[model samples]
Target: MALPSAPPRRRLRVAVVGAGVNGIAAAKAFRGAGHQVVCYEARAQLGGVWAPASHYPGLRLQAPRELYVFPDTGPLPPPEYDEEYPTAAKVYAYLKSYADKYGVTPCIQYNTRLVRAEPLYDRSDGGAATAASTAAAPGVAATVTVSALPTHAADGGKGLDGAAKGTAAAPAAGAAPAADAGVAAAVSSTGPAAAPVGWRLTLRTVPPELQQAEAGQCGGGGGGGGGGAAAAPAGPTLDKGGEGQDAGPREWAEEVDVLIIASGSFDDPKPPAYKGVQDFLAAGGEVLHTAHLRTALRRALAAAQTQKGQQQPRAGASGGAGDNGPCAIAAGASAPGPAVVTARFPAEPERGTEEGTEGGMEAGTDAGTEGGMEGAERDACRRFAQLLAGGRRVVVVGNGKSGDDVAAMLAASGAAASVTHLCRRNKWAVPRAFAGLVSLKWTLGTRAGVSLMRPLHPRPWPLGPLWEAARWPLLRLMEAGMRLQQGLAAAGAVPPHPLDVGLDASLHVEPPGYFAAVHGGRLQRRLGAVGALEAGAVVLGDGSRLEADLLILATGFRRSMPFLPPDLYGKIVRPDGTLDMYHAIYPHEIGGRSLFVLGWNPGLYGCLIADIAARWVLEMAEGRIRVSREQMRAYNERLYAWADAHFSPVAAADIRSGITVAYTWAHVDDMLHDMGASFARLTPWERLRLYCAPVAADLYTKVKATIPSERP
Candidate 1:
C-alpha cells in the first residue's frame, strides 16, 4: 500500500476523547506520527467500556486472543493471561498494559469530561471567523475548551497520584500542563487544505459532591452556594458556569489539530419501552438492563454472604484457583469457560424492533418478527445466567441469542422450575459445532462461504420464497449439518428453522443445549408477542399468560451520543439516525475534518477495524491520503445500496437499525480501497488463504512498512 507523500506540515496536537481500545489506538498512531497526543477518559480508568466497572462477572471476549489485538501494540495474550476468550478483567489489564507500553497512559487525563467542542478557525487568512463558516477553503484551525474535575472529591483533589493534576497557572479545570504550548502551536500550523485545526473542547470536571450540588441546583432545590476548588488552567477561561456569588463548574480551552471521538457505544443502555414496564418496576419487580447486571449480582451476593454469616457460614468458594477462565480477583466473579459448561459462541443477530402480525410467517413477506438487538449478546446471556437461580419462574423475552442462552442456562442449572421463552418469530439457528467436531464459524465465517451465500443480484422485491427455492441445495446441507449436531428432527423441532424469507431467517450460532433442553420439556418455547404485564404474569397476544417472577429484557443498547450538540450531531448522523460517513470513518464533506468517530463501525474484528481506521486517520492528518468529493459520494451510495439490499424488513423499517458493515472481507476491502491500496498487498497465496486462514494481525505492519516513512 503506497500513500502519496504528505506535504511538509508541522506536528499536530491530537486530542482523543475516551481511553477505550479505539481511543488508545488513535493516540498511539497519532503519537507515532510525531504528534502530541492527549486522551480524555471520563472514567478514572484507561479502558473505556471494558473497565471492570462496566462489565458483568462472567464477561469475556467473543474473539479469541489472536484476533483481539493490534499487531503493533503487543504480542497475543501469554499463558498468564486467560487465553481463548479472555475475561473482561484480563481485557482491561491487557489494554492498560498496551497503553503503558506506548506511553499513552501519561498522556491520558482521567476523570476529565468533554462538556462541549466548538470548532475554531485559524483566520490568519481571515475570510470568515464564525464556527459555522465553511472550512472547504484553507488556513482553518480548531481549539477545544474542556473541564477537568478531581478524580474523586473525597480523595482531596488528588488525580491518579497527582500525575493528572496540572499547575495552578493552567486552566481552572484540568488542562494540559505548561509543556503543551509548543504542541498547540504546531497543531495550528497544519496544512490548511489537508489537516485543518480540529476542535476547541470545553471540559468540566465534576466531583461527586459537586455533581450532586449541580443536580440539586438544576433541579430547582436552590442551594446555589456549591463552591469547589477549581483545577489548574491549560489556557484562558473561555466561560464560567456558576451564578454570581456561587462558584459552579470551571472551564478551560485546548487547541488541537485532530479530535478523535472514540467514545464507545456501551455507555448508554437502551431498555425496551414495554407498555407495563413502569408498573412492573413500581410493583417491586426488577428490570435490570444487562449492562448493570454485575452491580446487581454483586449486591445480591453480598446480601447472601451476610445472611450466611448470620447463620453458620460455610467456607467460601476459592477464587476458582487454577481455573482456565479469566476471573477478576477483585470482583470475586468467575468467567465462563469450557469447564462444566458446553462451549458456545454467540451469533450476530439482526437489529430492530419486532413488529409482526398475530399469525407467524404470513404470506412469505412477513418472515417473522421485527426488532434486532445490538452486538455483545454473548455477555448479556452470561449475566442473565447469573440471575437464573434466584427466580422461580423465568420468562426470557426476544428469542434471539439472549433468549436461547437463558433457556439453556435455566435447564442446565436446574434453577428455574418453569422457564418460558416468549419467541414472537422463528429465527435460523446453527449448532456451534457443525458436525460435532468442526466449529460452525470455520465453515461459514469466511469470505468464501459468505460470497457463496450472498445472492448474485440484489433481491429488492419480496421474492424470498423464490430465493429459498434457488438456494435449496445449500440450505439443505446447512440443515443436515445442524441436525447431525443437535438431532432437531429426532427431538421433534422439525424443519430446523424458519423459512429464509428475504434473509429473515439468517442462521446464527445456536447457544449450546437449547434444543435438547426444549425437547426434554424442561424449557418451553412459546411463539407470540407479549400483550402486557398483568399483576404477576406476562399476558401473551394470543390470549394466554405465563406467570414469571423475573423478566429478562435481553434487549440491546442505544448507540447514540446524546452529549454531542444537536446541530453537530444532526449533520454527522443521517435522518434515520445511522451515521453518514465514508468507510464508516470519514465524512464525505470537508467540514468533518475537525471531528472523527471510531468504534461505531459495525463488523467483526472490531479491534482490527479500529486499527485500520486509526492508520487512515494518521494518514489524513499528515496529508498523505486524499479522495475526490465525487468518489466519496459514489462510495457512500454503494454502501447505502448494499444496506438496502441486505437488511431484513424489520431492519429496513428504521434507517438506523441495519448493520452498517455486514461482513469482514468486504468491509476491509472497502477500507483498503479508500486508503489507496488493494487486497493485492497480500501475496497471491495469502490472498487465496484469506477466507480460510486466520486473519493476519501483522497485516497493518506490512502495510505501514510498504509506505515511505514520514519525517517522524
Candidate 2:
C-alpha cells in the first residue's frame, strides 16, 4: 500500500495527549503528513490499556486478532499467536512492535500527564479571548498544562528509558525545555511572523514521593502498574512555610499548533457508589475493579503464604518446590489461565422459579434460611479459602466483556466457592465463530453484513434498495443463528432485548466456558443493581444479600476531558452527558480546525477505526476536508437523534462510551466516504472478496491508498 505523500503546506506542530493505539495512529498520521508530532503518555509504556500494569489474569482480546491490528501494520502472525484472540501480553508486544515499525516510539514522551488545556484564541483585535471566540489568526491557539510524573521501578518506566529515544534529556528542576528546534526553525523560515492560532502548553514535573504514593493506591507494584493514577487528584500543593506559600511539582509551558486528545475513554474507572462501602472496606472485605485483579490476587497469595508459615513451623510446609498445593500454578506461572472443568447443567427449574417480574431474580425468598451454625461454618471456610486462592465467594458486577471474562476466570480457576454475576441487563453474547463454522469477521464484520442492518444514515445505491427489502429477514436470520450458537436458552441467558437493538448498545463476545460455568451452577447469573454494601455481603436491589469475600466491579468507565475548561468541555458533551462530536472525532462547535479527539467513540475494530479517524484528521488539517460549524452541528444532531431512536434506553444514556458492535463497519464506511475513498475503487474480484471473505486490517490498506496524497 502506498503511503500518503507529504502535502505541499507548512508543517504543523502536532501535540497528541496519549500514546495508546489511537495516539500512535494520530502521531503516525501527522508525521506522515510532514508535521512535527509529539505524543505524551502518562505511563512509561505505550500500549495504554494493554500496558502490563493494566492487565489482569485471563485478559484476552474480545475481538478476533485480525480485527485488532492497525490498518497500516496488518495482522499478528498466525505462527506467533495461533489463536483467534491474543492475550493482553501478546497485544502489548504487538503494540510496541507497531510503534517501532512506524517510528512513533521516538515521538512519544513517556511519564508525561495532561493536566489542563486552555484555548488561546487569537485576539489581535484587542478583544478578550474566550473558548467561543472564532478568530482564525494562526500561531498559538491553546495552552495545555501537563505534568511529568516521576518514574518508579513498578511503573515499567524503563521501557524507553524514561524519555523518547534520540530526544533531548529532561531539563533541570523548575526549568522549561525550549520549543522543538526543528519546528522553531521551520516557523521562522516560512513567514515573517508565526501563526497566532496555535496552542501554548504548560508542563510540570511531579514530586517523586507524591507520585509514588498515588501509584500505590492504583496497584503500583510490578506488573500492576499505576493504571488508576488518572483518578488521583492533580494540582499544586501548599508548602509548610505558610498558607500563602505556593509549593508543588515543578511547572513550565510550551506551545503547539494542533492538539489531539487521544487520551481514550477508560482513564477513570466508574465503580458504583453504593451505601456502606466504607463499612465493607473497614470490615476487611476487598473491592476491586477488574483492572486491579492481578494486584489484588497477588496480595492475597502473599498473605496466604505468610499465614501458612505461621501455622506450620516446619520447612516446606507452605509447599514443596514441586508440590501442587492449593495455590498451584495454572496455565502460566505468572498469570492464571482458564481451567478446564466438566459441565453439568441443572435440571429445569420448577414453574415458579422463572425470572421474576421485579429484578430478574428467581421468584423465591432469599437463600439465607440455612441453619445458622452451618452458614457460619460455610462463611468461615470460604474466607479461609480466599486466602489460599481456593474457595472464596466472589461477586462480579456488570455483563460487559470484562465482567464476563473475570467471572469466567474465577469460576474456572477452581478457586472461588461460588461466582455470582450481577447485571442490570442481559446482553446478546456473540460468539467469535458462529456454530464453530463461520467466522464473524467474514459475516457481520464485513460491509455486506453491515448493509443488512438499519443504518443511521442513508445507504448508497444498490445496498440501500437491498437493505430496504431484506433488513428484517436478514437480521432475524442472523439472530436465530446467534441464539443457536450461543445456546442462550439452554444457558438461561436469553437477553430481554432483541439482537438488533442490542447491537446499538454493546456487543460482548461470550467468554470460553462462560455459559458452561453458568449451566453447571458454578456461576450464578442474576439481574439487579448493587443496592448497597454491608459487612462481608452485597445487598441487591431486591433486598436480597449474598455473602462475598471479594467484590469485583467491572462496571466500566467514565469518559471525560477534565483538563478542558468548563465552557469548552460543555460544547463537546451534551446536556444528558453523551458526547456530541462530529464523526466522534471533531468537536462540533470547533469544526476540526485546531482540535481533534480520537478513540472517544465506542466501537468494534478500534484499531482500524482509530486509524481511519486519524487519516481523516490529517485530511482536515491539510484542508482536504472542510465544513462550517453549522454543518458540523447538523451532522451531530442527526447522529444524536439516530442513537436515541435506535439504542436501548439504558444503552442510550451512555451510548458514546460502549462498543457499537456491528455498526462499527458502517461507521468506518461513513468515514471512508467522507475522505472520498471507498471499496468501490477496488477491482471486481477484490471487492467481491471484501464483502464475502473474512476482513482483516490489511484489507483497508488498498482503500486508503486511494485517498488523495495532497490537497488540490
Candidate 3:
C-alpha cells in the first residue's frame, strides 16, 4: 500500500462547506487528527438537507444506527440501537446533538454561502525558471480552474440543458489550445510565500419558488455540484454581499482554503426530454430542490412565520405517538421484541390479471431456484428490520419497492412509528414491506404514523418495474402478497401499475410517475437510456402542452464532483454533443487528475459504500497517490478495449441509468466488491491537494485499524 506523506507542520485553516452530516463527519475527523476546521452552511444550521423536515412527518434513516450514525459519537435519545426505526424529528434532534457534542457547532458558520470555488494560483516565484507551486501554503493569484468534462472526449462538455443553446458548438480544427496554459510564470506565482485563507467561492441567493405559501418551496441540488438544471424561468435573484449592484439581485461569493461541498444530492432528476415536466418543468413551476423545499417549509411554518407550524400527518397514518426514549438493545443483531418484521403487501384488487405484481412473481420464481430461496426474502426483510430496530429511525429513501420493503419490514418488526416511507415516484405500488402494515397505519391517520407518499420520478415513463433488477423484489413482494392472501393470483392490482402507466382508467394515475427504487428497483436499469431517452413527449421541441402538479424526474444526477461542471454521471460531451469521461472519472488523457470526478459512481447499498471512497479521499489528502492529469484519456485507452470485449455497464447502453439492484443475501457484498474495485483501481493520489492540515488519511488508518467491523 502507498504510504501517507508526513503531516503538515503549520496550523492549517480548513473550510468545510455544507454543515450537514458529511460536513460534521469531516470536521470531526479533521479535528481528531489536529486540524483547525471551519464549517459553513448556506442556511443557518449544521444539518444540510436534514435541517428542515419537508416530508419530516415520517422521516427516518434506512441503514441501522450502526451504519448511519458517525464514528465516536452517539445519537440523542441514544437510539434503541436494536429496537425500531426512530422518527424524523428524533433524527433531526439527534443530528443537532451530534454536532453539539463534537463542538462542531462553534466552528460552523451558518448562513454563509459559497457559490464558486476558484483555487488561487501562485505567481510570486516568477523569477524561477520553472513554475514553483506550494501545496502546503495558499496565498495565490489567478483562479486555478478545475474542469471535469465527460468520460469521453469530443462529446461537448456543455450538457443538454435547454437554455445553454447558442454557445455550444464544435471546436474549429487545429485551433490553438487556449484552454491550456504554458507560461512558467503562470504556474510559479502560487509558491509558498502567500498563505491562502480559503477558496473564492460564489454564492448566489435565489428567491423562493412558488408554493402554496403554507407548504414552503425553494431550489437546490447535489453537494459539490456546479451545474444548473434547465434554469427556471427568469426571476429575481437574491443579492448577497450587496456591493455595487446590477438591476437584478446578484449572488454572493466567499474565499476559503478548502471547500467541502455538501449540497446533498439530486434524486433521479428528469432528463431535458421527459413529457409533462413542462408544467413543473415549465415557467411557473417551483424549482423546489429537495432540501430547499424542506428549508422553505420550516421557514413558512416558523412560529413567527405562522401559527405553531401546523404540520399535517400524511394521507394515511397512525400508531404510537412516537418513541419516547431509546431502546435498550446492544450491538448484537436482531431487534429486541416479539414483533418480528415481515412485508405487508397491498392486496391485488383482482390478483394476477394485472401484469406487474403477478407478472413479477412469475418472473421471479421462473428466474431463481425456489427451494433454497424460499426463506431468503424473509431473511432479507428480517435483516433490514434488524437494521432499523438498531437505529433511532429508519429513512426509507429511493424511488421504488426497496423503499416500500424498507417500510414494511420496519413496521412489522414491532417497529415504533419513527419511519418515513419516501417513494420517489407518485405512481407505483407500495413495497410489500410497507404496503399493508404501514399503509394501514397511513390510512388510519395519526401523527408519528406512516407517511406513505411518492416524491416523484421524472423519467419519461411513469411505471418502471420493467428494469431487470426489479424482478427479484417485485417477485418477492408477489410471493409475500400471495402468502398473505392465499389463492390470490401472482399479480397485484396492476390496473394503473405503480405509476398508473397503462391504467388511465383509474383516476388515481396522477401522472408524475413511480419510483423505480421500489421492487428491487432493478427496472430502472431496463428503462435507463444511455442517451437522453427517446422522449415520446416533448415541450418546446414540440408544441406539446404538458402538466404535472408534481413532475419528478427519475433521471439520475451527478453523484461525485458536484462542484465540477455538469456532465451526466461522469460522461462529458464535447461541444459536438458527444460524451467521454475517461473511466468515468476524468474527461480524457487531456484532463488533469486534479480536475476529475469520483463518488458520482452509483452504488447499491448505502452512501460511501463500505467507506472505501473515504479511504481513497484520505489517501489523496496525504498525497500518497498521484492521479495523472491525463485522466480517463490514459485509462480510457485500456478500458475502451475492455468495454469492447465485455460491454460492462459502461458499454452496455441498457442498464446505464439505474442504481445497482441485485439485493439478494449477497447484495451488500456486491456493493462492497464493486466499490473496492473502483477504489483499488484508480487511487485518489491524482487529486489536487486542496488543504494541507486535513488528515483524512491518518483518520482512515486509525479507524480501519481500530474500529471493529459491524457486519451488515
TM-score list, all predictions:
0.69, 0.73, 0.44
lDDT of 1 by residue, 97-199 (tens): 8877887777776445665555544333322222332332122223222222112111112222232223232333533221222222332233332223355
Off by over 4 Å in 3: 1-11, 71-83, 122-199, 202-257, 267-612, 626-703, 706-712
In angstroms, give how far residue 506 of model 2 lies from its true place: 3.1
Ranking by TM-score: 2, 1, 3
TM-score of 3: 0.44
lDDT of each: 0.48, 0.54, 0.29
By how many angstroms RMSD does model 3 differ from the true structure?
19.2
The window of 10 residues in a row where model 1 has the poorest summed lDDT is: 217-226
User: Model 3 Cα displacement at 606 (Å)?
Assistant: 4.2
lDDT of 3 at 288: 22
Candidates ranked by lDDT = 2, 1, 3
- Residue-by-residue lDDT tens digits, candidate 2, 5-48: 33346666677877777888898989887787777666555666
Which is the leading candidate under lDDT? Answer: 2
Question: How many residue pairs clash per model?
Answer: 32, 20, 103
Residue-level error in angstroms, candidate 1, position 7? 5.9
Error of 1 at 102 (Å): 2.6
